[model samples]
Target: MKRLVFILLLVFAGICCSCKNDDDGGCVGVDCLPPETQTGENTFGCLLDGEPFIPRGGVNPLDCVYQLIDGERYFNLEAAMNDAGFNEIAISITTNAKEIIENQTYSLVSEFEVGGVSGKYIFNGDIFDTDNQNSGKLTITHLDIDNQIVSGTFFFDVIDQNGELREIRDGRFDMKFTR
Candidate 1:
């Protein structure tokens, strides 16, 4: 019995020592986080869920990065960097949906996930209410720097804890962006 107790104490001490510091301010274990960046055209360098943060030289059609929490939306690196204090950030754009997703047309939505806590994003001409990191949108309008004069949607679906996608059904409504 004494040997067992001694072993357990040593194990606990080791676990306590293994925890690394998270300098990001907002998250614990922030350094363990993965960032997927869109580089070049329709390509990306990603080190995502369960994978080590190894920059994939380039992959086709980059998918938006996200994490799921109780049916609400959470933003990853891009969105987090866009506005740290501001939970939501709005940027007007002028382009089609396909163009924006491809990064061919500039956009302003970046986040890692959508739900444990809610963050807001304004896209096209509507506000998106994020639930469990699942639902949100991004919109753009005609701005002086760029002028396409079109509408687009930045929709998000909840992702399961295992890094799997949870299907979202279609609906029509105006979701509000808190920012």
Candidate 2:
């Protein structure tokens, strides 16, 4: 079976990696990655697409699972919208991450799911170490923000629905705001 073969391959790969014969060999094992380069933005071409994106500085997937912090403003930029009005109105976003509007502030977390690919990401969310895609047909049910009505344009990197992936990058939506 494919599963059995995959498991055997992994076992062999692990053994070969531990062996001290990698300096020059036929099977180099799972490319020995640097300590800090084990997992990177989706651009790195990762098979397992889980959250906590960077494992550190970046917004851990856990944060996305929490409730949007209270007191944080959630303005409906659209005066009113319906199924026929999605994305037609404007939405301005401003976070307290910065002192004023002129400063680069907080980053919004957007969930993406389609064609067997899913993951939580930012505007230019890279799919690891690859030039997957940052633009795709958007389907938004709400637009909460603060300040002007949708200021700058928001960007998104869409995964290649038909591209290769080792993991299904699905995610749970639970965004909370904090000060």
For 1-179, candidate 2 gives per-residue lDDT tens digits of 99999999999999998978533243322232112211111111111233211111222322211113453322211111111222221111222222222222223333221111122222232232112343212122222233121221122233343454423121111122232
lDDT of 2 at 142: 22
Each model's lDDT comes to 0.29, 0.26
Over the full model, what C-alpha lDDT does candidate 1 score relative to the true structure?
Answer: 0.29
Q: What are the C-alpha RMSDs, in order, of all predicted structures?
A: 16.5, 18.2
Off by over 4 Å in 1: 1-4, 20-86, 89-93, 96-179
- TM-score for candidate 2, residues paired by index: 0.19
Error of 2 at 103 (Å): 26
Off by over 4 Å in 2: 1-61, 64-130, 133-138, 146-164, 167-172
Top-scoring candidate (lDDT): 1
